[model samples]
Target: MTILIPAMTQAENHPVSLTDDRGKTIELAQPATRPAAISTFGADVSVALGRQPVAITTFGLQGVPAYLGPEMEKIPSLGPRHQPNLEQLSRIAPDLVFAIRRYTEKDGPQIEAIAPMVAMDLITLQDSLDAVALAGDALGRPQQAREINQRFKARLDSLAARSPGNRTVAILTSGGETPFVYYDHFLTASLLERLHFDNVGGSPPNPESGIPLGYRISLEALLALNPDVILLLPSNRQRGFTVNPVWPYLQAVKNDQVFEVGQHWKESAGPIARSLVLDDIERLLLPDDTPLKTSSR
Candidate 1:
């Protein structure tokens, strides 16, 4: 923690007590009225929870994706995650700062100089939902967060109830030249697990690194698994699959089962993003014989 962080407490001191994913507790004079999120993910959550922080991180601010809508572009941005402009940040007069452990671990002390911080585990599926709750608490809107989470879970429950039950799928991302299969604990994969879709992600979350791992499976490895469906993120078009030498022979490739997705898959935790993910799962992965479930719970 940074030396700049204010000494926090309740009663005679800061009025509200909040605990982050790292188990670090912070006491706020009151619920934050003007917060600054440290990343695009945090910014999206703020809007989803109806708070819409005044400041967001610099990197990827433009790439916040269409799902976040126009408000994303309206907010001012801090410097990169590792180093933000403290003088500029102070000018914003933010009451609170929200960040993930990835950023907090490296820059917590420096960021603390601007405002007290709430750093949480937001890299995976479970963390994302937790982040929504934290944002709600920070903004004094816990009920809204609860309602949103319940709705998200209910939608998943509906999907699970109507799932085909015995199908395998693989997620591929266009963030790189060759699509890499995401690990089981990644946001989208976790949603797939909830929907009862058999996942082919051979990797899992790495405990030491505190990061969910992804592997760019070779053509031979992909051929061996031959998952029933291949979800393509960042790009929905599947014609690019032809670049791989054995792409034409893959089952998902041949059967027209390759589905394209948007930023929601990448941002599995955002309220709106997760909702879209469920929508896509129902539209693309479910069996034609299965009755479609309404997106609304």
Candidate 2:
């Protein structure tokens, strides 16, 4: 017979006990409950752990994906991860808040006053997997979290096996006057890297201010790259709802190699979204004799 015990919490000034990546003891004020995920990645972790957050940071106009098991829509919107709404957050009265350390550090005192806040470090794929596990443990749902991690790894392996080598790919943000090129470290670039595609160049120099969080490139720069495949992320604007003006000119566009990525797949970090991203990339990278529609726009 198996026995279940309540999750552990750290005593006052006694160091909240948790294990790090290296299996070192990590101390915090208490176990996480009623968590407010300050980033999409953190929200993914919370959802995987079976604890529905009271509030979550928003992504864009499309909002959270419908397939996040339907409980997502009920959570109160706390605005963007980069810029959280303190007023809404205060009303939620979260017991713990999980966010990227870089973004949360500045508002530490303010957030801590409402509740104990912990900064999660999720840089690489490994880091993300570990963070998920940690979140599961904190939320008393370790088994479910491990299963999700295992499934994701298995899917990644399958994608790697089916992928063709030496395909040059580029990720672009569209719907504006000028399309933008994404850097290697961005989430979309990370997804492409998993499928063994090569990003054409390094990050763009000094992307425009307040143009989302990516590097911008001119049409001339995109043509210079000469990629075999192009993945376009649409904006939440009127122009995005209609046709793409620059689609007819590019090499990939001319060759019918352009593919449209949905907002949920490109933006969210949860299991379902990641799986969709993997499937989309597989369809593009694998050689199928059937000629399908080029643009989903």
Q: Which candidate number has the best lDDT?
A: 1
Residue-level lDDT tens digits of model 2 in 1-297 = 011223453232333445543333444554566888787766777776667888888777666656565788888988877778888999999877777655676776787788666565454455566677666656656678789989988877666665664777787775766666766555557667766778764543443221234566766676778788887776775433124555466677778887877765454455556666777777766765423423321
Instruction: Provide the TM-score for each candidate, comma-separated.
Output: 0.84, 0.76
Q: What is the C-alpha RMSD of each candidate to the true structure, in Å?
A: 5.1, 7.4
63: Cα error in model 2, Å: 3.0
List the candidate 2 regions with Cα displacement exceeding 4 Å.
1-30, 121-123, 201-214, 238-247, 287-297
Q: lDDT for model 2, on a 0 to 1 scale? A: 0.65
Q: For candidate 2, what is the total of clashing residue pairs?
A: 1
Candidate 2 collision pairs: 16-28
What is the C-alpha lDDT profile of model 1 across 150-185, one tens digit per residue?
988877787787886667889886544456788877
